[model samples]
Target: MYNFIENKNTDGVVFFTIPSFEKTKLVKHGFSSKIGGVSKGSYESLNLGFKTNDLKENVENNYKKITKALDLSIQNLVFSDQVHKDHIKIVTKKDCGKGIIKESDIKEIDALITNEKNVALTTVFADCVPIFLLDPVKKVIALAHAGWRGTALKIAKKTVEKMIQVYQTNPKDCLAAIGPSIGRCCYEVDEGVIKEFNKEFTNVDEFVFSKGNGKYMLDLWKANQSTLKEIGLLERNITISNICSMCNSEIFFSYRKDEGITGRMAAIIELE
Candidate 1:
């Protein structure tokens, strides 16, 4: 199980700490909120995405604060230029600080995985689900960004598969933490998305329900959970944060809730 830790810094962000791996010096994982940065106006503070209209200096400063709070080195961080796809990149020590300084250095990736120690894998999001996977036994960690399209592609399960293939990790020994995102209460989907989800999910009714007015609400968090379980992870190994980015826009950024002009939060995982 994982325990949620609220950051003392006014950033309103909370990270989940897994008790089973706490004593091990293997991996560190955290999901960020929008409370602790130097940006102003639309971005406000703690925005991690550099492509946003926020000042580059503020984004850099915010990265410093986040690294300090997470007890990680900015030099070893590897970021993703997410295109909402299922492309998972296997990061190595040589790829450190790639996407942060040079946008061209960032590969078109949506998930990052690595077994190397001290190399952080990061993915940015506004309302998309940030799924963090850790194989404490294998000392492998992966971070996934799953929006509707990525979720339909089963990116979370693909990340687990990659870990197993690349690092010899077992899904049963892996623990997953599903982070804050747009909950079903606010994630209304149209008929096309709902139909596609039905095709992908076996028990589609459980995660997708009618919300009246010809709209349907989809529980992406649970969808990812089911995907993990289907990929051999035990149901008990998944820990989901019930926080909704859309509902709690004051604490976290939401692209749909904020009309796409918002900053992004980050979910990072690394082997220590």
Candidate 2:
């Protein structure tokens, strides 16, 4: 249902763009992949995260690689510090280049929504979900980072509500894409996490499955998708990559697959 087109630039970096949003002409968006980069060791290549031990120069180059591929400006990017919360920051021209070049971080923000042109909103991911929303009619877009905690807080739903409050966006006119993350097959959780999800979502049974070992596998992709649909995004307009990071570690970074020390991938959206 989602069109994630893979393109390899001359630098050999593999990045993905949404074909659905590509037609807008007003914005450009894409997700980074594991392929193509300058970092070494566990980072290998294409790690856009700077918080890690990966050389600052390598991470910067990785960002440059993607900007070159997507025809975006690395300097115009605004990043989410991603505390796994539902907090949303409204982006504007003043916030451009905050997390990339001008400043180091935008503290405590997990989602970024913007209507301003050339201000690319970015959020990192490993096993957690990345929700991308675009309201073409309103010329607004949001990038949400939904870890299990953020999912329980219903970050996806919060993003939609924020768009409504800020841009007066109608959810029906929005396009949502749940990007690659750990799938139900590998995201096993204990009772504590299960309790959290149950507390926030009444229809938890729809996405939570029993593993029969005092553990449950949570389908965050489905959880976030349900959040979008419940908020009025058409089922047809929402797409799931269904690509599990744990399973495709070669092509994508996976927190679980790499055991807590791995490179990072980013979901980036920019208004033209």
Which residue ranges in model 1 land beyond 4 Å of their true spot? Answer: 1-3, 9-25, 102-104
Best TM-score among the predictions, by candidate number:
2
Taking the tens digit of each residue's C-alpha lDDT, what string does model 1 give over 116-166? 888889888899998888888887888999999899889999999999888
TM accuracy, model 2: 0.97
**In candidate 1, which residue pairs clash?**
11-35, 37-46
| Residue 6, candidate 2: alpha-carbon lDDT | 75
Q: Write the per-residue lDDT of candidate 2 for residues 60-92, one digit (tens) a residue.
A: 999999888889888888988888887889878
Mark the 10 consecutive residues where model 1 has the least summed lDDT.
1-10
How far residue 93's Cα lies from its native spot in candidate 1, in Å, is: 0.3
RMSD to the hidden true structure, all candidates: 2.2, 1.3
Give, for candidate 2, the lowest lDDT window spanning 10 residues: 1-10
TM-score of 1: 0.93
For all candidates, the clash counts are 2, 0
